[model samples]
Target: MATFNKFFSSVFLAVLYASSYGNAAPWPTNAKHGTHRVRTLGKGVQVEAFHPPSSYKTYGAGVDLASSFTSSGIEDKTVSYISSELQVDSAKVTFKSGYTQNGQSFAYAKQVHNGIPVSNAVANVAFKDNKVIAFGHSFVDTSKIAPSTPSVDVNAVIPKTEEVLEGKKNEIEPTLEYHALADGSVALAHVFQVQNDEAGTWYKAFVDAHTGDLISVTDYVADASYKVLPVNKELITDGLELVTDPQNTASSPSGWHSDGKSNTTDTSGNNVVAYKGSVSSTTKQSADNLVFDYTYDTTKAPDVANNVNAARTNAFYLVNSYHDTLYQYGFTEASFNFQNDNFGKGGAGNDRIRISVQDASGTDNADFATPPDGQSGQCRMFIWTATNPKRDGVLENDIPLHEVTHGLTNRMTGGGTGECLQSLEAGGMGEGWSDIVADWFSHSDSADVTDFIMGQYVTNDPAGIRSHPYSTSASTNPLRYSDIAKLDEVHNIGEVRTVHPEMVLFKSLTFFFLPNPL
Candidate 1:
């Protein structure tokens, strides 16, 4: 219930935020009075309002909200305030100019009216939950002021020298376009192609046009090739839809496996059983590629509640651990819910899907609630039974990040193995990178290194090992990239030991080595 409340509350706040600017009152001054109130908020700005108090004639004056009090008409109010300059336009007598936010001066016009600047300027500035209120000589209300950022007109010509970003070979060309939403945030959209044996799909990224920062990306799979079947709508929703692979000509179908087949039981008195399924590929993409399509299942009462809480806790850790310098980022949108039939089937035999879930009171021969090696417990991913309705969402589970990292690394950098010794020999750095990200998400680092492994939080028979270090070894050379050597000389301890004494001079020089960002 607490989870439900929090989820709803967040949704409500977001809706309210998207709704009207609730109590944002306008400049709070009459246009006819040249004498108006001036207010200040903190040190960022001051606002002064002016209305032509006595001008019933052709002359009039108005207040300038932006730093640049650039006037628009031909009447003069002849008002002056501390540290402010006014420029007069002869043709438009009411037209006058003042300072711009950029520190350059600009011109504006006002109607003929009273001669003194307004006073008693109370201002209100909204921040996160707190309103900054102040009084100042010049009242500059910028709350409703919008900036005119640089933008290319839609029909503008593309410069021959203007380079466009591209994807790799066999990839669909990106669709780049500038957008001005009817509601007004300028955005840029870029499309990329994604291919599966069944069919090809497209993904899009949205960026802030003015800032060039990625705001979001939407995944799109062609409905003809893939079907989006939803099983749960109450609490969770899956963005990716599941559909049968057109390339698959298989005739046989196995019932989705359930946890009841195994000894696994839910001790929390929740609907304990789970579901699992997979699609077989005609040919393996790679040894490191996702062995099979994904599976999902619903959590029982307490499981639902527990998982939601866990999601928030972990999300907080991830958000704080990185991007601390910037006040907010994508993680602020953390949410928890179940998903079903997320990915479509693949093109032959049994599909291998990874399953994980938290065990309650160790009834299912699962690991202790806490890690054995004093490592912190990580969120786990359990296999979903096909019959089950609720399955974990990527945001709700950390496993997706870890497992997806492995898949991405394998795809991006040629397939690599995760075997301890061999990975140390050739793929150790990659392996460490995975672990670093996994641990880093939990805000764990070398300074706070613990014995937790990638899947330690899974409620599996034996909890995954947590004693793993980023590198298989350690080194005395402070400047060397911490690799397998930092943990131990296991790769070739004897040879390394023997060569160390004879090559002390070379080894000492290693101290000056600095690693390049990979």
Candidate 2:
């Protein structure tokens, strides 16, 4: 089943950013002081807005509290402005971070009351030319709220937290923290980080210290590893062809197409390694190595295990190669590329892309899962067994590339939070993006690149799995925006909008802006 987690905040921010792009109007030269507008933002909070002169087309609003302000002075001014305008105490708000971007300074703050942090209570302030230009806040009044005191000891809550963890031991000792509940109340809780090594599960549990009841639990190790020895080998894609060894790229077939290294110790390393599925479905068992020889006769089908091994090698090479190719377009570690080992200097340091082949029960599909940021992303390719001769999903390049692109779109958008592409339209856009990227990677001038057929070899179908090939020709597939309301499936809608107009516009801009070699 296809599912996408909803991320409303990220989606709203994306729209706001897109709306403001390339629409900057000239700033007013004669801006005056004491000319500001105030608006109520519900929950007893207000925002004092100061816009540039009427002539400026750029949209920005904030409090005009100061003529000149620095990073150090932003918090004081923010608190002072909010306190005066909203009639709230400055001590109730806490500043989180202040930084400069694109010649504008931005700061984020959170609300706290009675020693308990307010959930979903936030404020953002922006400044330009040393003057406040934009400010927005979601606040809660704490004047009448009472502080919560724990009745139960931390030791008493440990057993309750451990019970919810199913006997998983706490990696870190339980700590006391205040949590804001949904009903606008605060509670003292004991937070525990629990893990089960054999099962490869990690969880964070918050247990109420007053009642010893479990408040919430989040699985950090969201259900989501190899070996190698080889030089050159014959692999099959369209047909049997000698390719570079995946283990060591610098061998006799020196310039082998799929040459890359593998490392089992470092989970976040650049090595493209493949591992066998675990024996138990619930627990994460150690992976066994898939030994590769120099050559294989593709004319005759090999054993199922051997076939999967070859597919794994091909997938590793293709993913790594695409990773390198995309690097030129800013898909680096700083930009949240899905590789454990990042060569770039920016982004979360330990995040990496992990691939698993032929996982559990030999299912007929592949899926990509991206957990919260700073955690490794996972892609699983299953075995296709419906046909007379069973097929390995990894054997085909398009399938693996399609799954990998999910990680790309998830990471690159929404600041690597994996939340930007979760809406209905975004979901359809995601499927289309994957298909386009897969075609781009596997395309050749002589091949039918524009046909938009997927998994033809794996599924053994001439027309492939999709209902129709995505094309611009009206006679072949004339899909328009009006058809969206009638379609209920994401993939179906994606096929109809085969070539997204936004994607076309983006490519055009990229080609125009980037330096031409010629």
Candidate 3:
């Protein structure tokens, strides 16, 4: 996070002085007007008889205060106060808005000079108990600012905007606005809004009206990706495993997971599809997606209501965590994440992940499908029933992580456009990467890498779901590049290259040394 050191120098000195006086000192009070109590702290900066109780104080340049204050007629009161303190004309300060709370209010005003608004010049006055308390200002010196008019017309800048946006320009007239420059000066600029529906891009461009040069641009769309109440039922992650009940199953409260704001119906946020009915085709059907509204029932055994609810909640949490973590590492809107809420900034909407729980078509398999760009990716987690008992694919953490990693690898590796790792050799590499990631999450501790098994809970088999548990020993997996022809399947071939001792060493080195390298 960035700190405003340039704006808080006086406040820091005041804090040090207050610390010397000890805690019992009375709160700092502002001095009387037209007195020597006001002292110059820095160039164009002044401080009055300030004795704040806390270590923090608000101070700024071009800030002045009035002799008296009142809550009623706030605009007139604030304008008069600023005019007297800064020794500027009262007509120059214009009231913007009043931010109010219980017995407190903050009047925000902007400075307009010679019919042109001064960019970044603001005056804020704090009031408590209907009396003046504190204030801060960052006003430009009006005498130093020279008046100017725009030279180029708005129509002349349209072509330049289209060229920069590479998309259709929004059909709106460009507005003339004063923009602040890097040197603390303001200029007349025309702001243009441009968007491209095909590419899911939107931004605002500021063009210098005098020279037709692009001053700056701000992108609007941001990545915001969500919900449920009723009797909350969810799967709680107990270390590496997920358990239905965090406490006693019969008496404990509902443990359903939530992002704290969204509801049970998945259509609103992040749009997870956890359905119970069967589907005729492998593709996701919007109508068949389950809506989580079940009341809590502890006595009920692994039924659809509790099991599917847990699946939906766990899937939403896991996918969102991975998405946000990857975003910090640069997998952002340009990289194509599955989300609908673009945060009013830049993102291709309608790309939410479609997750299907207990897909009826198969009982022992789970998979993720990465469609073309701008389309929703589909993830199907099937039930495991090959053994004497049945197991849900969602209950286990490794299964979902392994499946979702496929989508991440697909979108990130190909520049958000084409398929990645399509050849036989590449397919093996893809599977190996997914397994390695899942293992990282499932491992008991950072140093413990002896166990590299996948889906141990879902499958009772000693080897788990794979042909052989992953190991860093040549005896367990001795296949070399020349042995690629010996195996035809992708998973089998992946084991040959994945379990090599050299690959394990490389993964360990990167995981421990790199900062968010994944």
| 10 residues in a row with least lDDT, candidate 2 | 509-518
Superior by lDDT: candidate 2 or candidate 3: 3
Q: Considering summed lDDT, which 10 consecutive residues are worst modelled in model 3?
A: 222-231
Global local distance difference test of model 2: 0.48
**Stretches of candidate 3 exceeding 4 Å from the true structure:** 1-268, 271-273, 278-304, 344-347, 506-518
Candidate 1: Cα lDDT at 50: 25
- For 1-518, candidate 1 gives per-residue lDDT tens digits of 33323332332222111111112212123221123223221222333322111111100122333333224211122222112332322221222222111111122222121221111111111112111111111122323222333243322212110112121212334444333232323344332322221112222333333444433322221110112122111112223233333221121111121111332111110111121112110111111321222222234432454443332222222212221211121111111011111122211111122222332212211110111111111222332322243233323223444433332222112101111111112222223333333433443222442323333323231233233222223342222322224333222221222122221222122111112211
Q: Which one is best on lDDT?
A: 3
- Compared with the true structure, what per-residue lDDT tens digits does model 2 show for residues 1-518? 01001122222232222112111222123322111223222122333322111111223554445433344475676566556545778777776544443355445555666555543344555566666664555455444343466788877667655555655655456666554454555556677666543333455555677778765443332111222111111113445343332333221112222122343322223523344464121111123332232232334343354455555555555555566555544455555665444434445644455567766633667767655455666677776665655666766667777777777666654345453333334455456667656655554332333545677766777676677665535566556554644664556655644444332222222111111111
Reference-based lDDT, each prediction: 0.23, 0.48, 0.49
Name the candidate, 2 or 3, with the larger TM-score value: 2
Clashing pairs in 2: 61-133, 61-134, 244-256, 339-352, 340-352
Q: TM per model?
A: 0.22, 0.55, 0.44
Sort the candidates on TM-score, descending order.
Answer: 2, 3, 1
- Counted clashes in each candidate structure: 67, 5, 15
Q: What is the lDDT of residue 357 in candidate 3?
A: 68
RMSD of each: 24.9, 12.5, 20.3
Residue 146 alpha-carbon offset, candidate 3, angstroms: 64
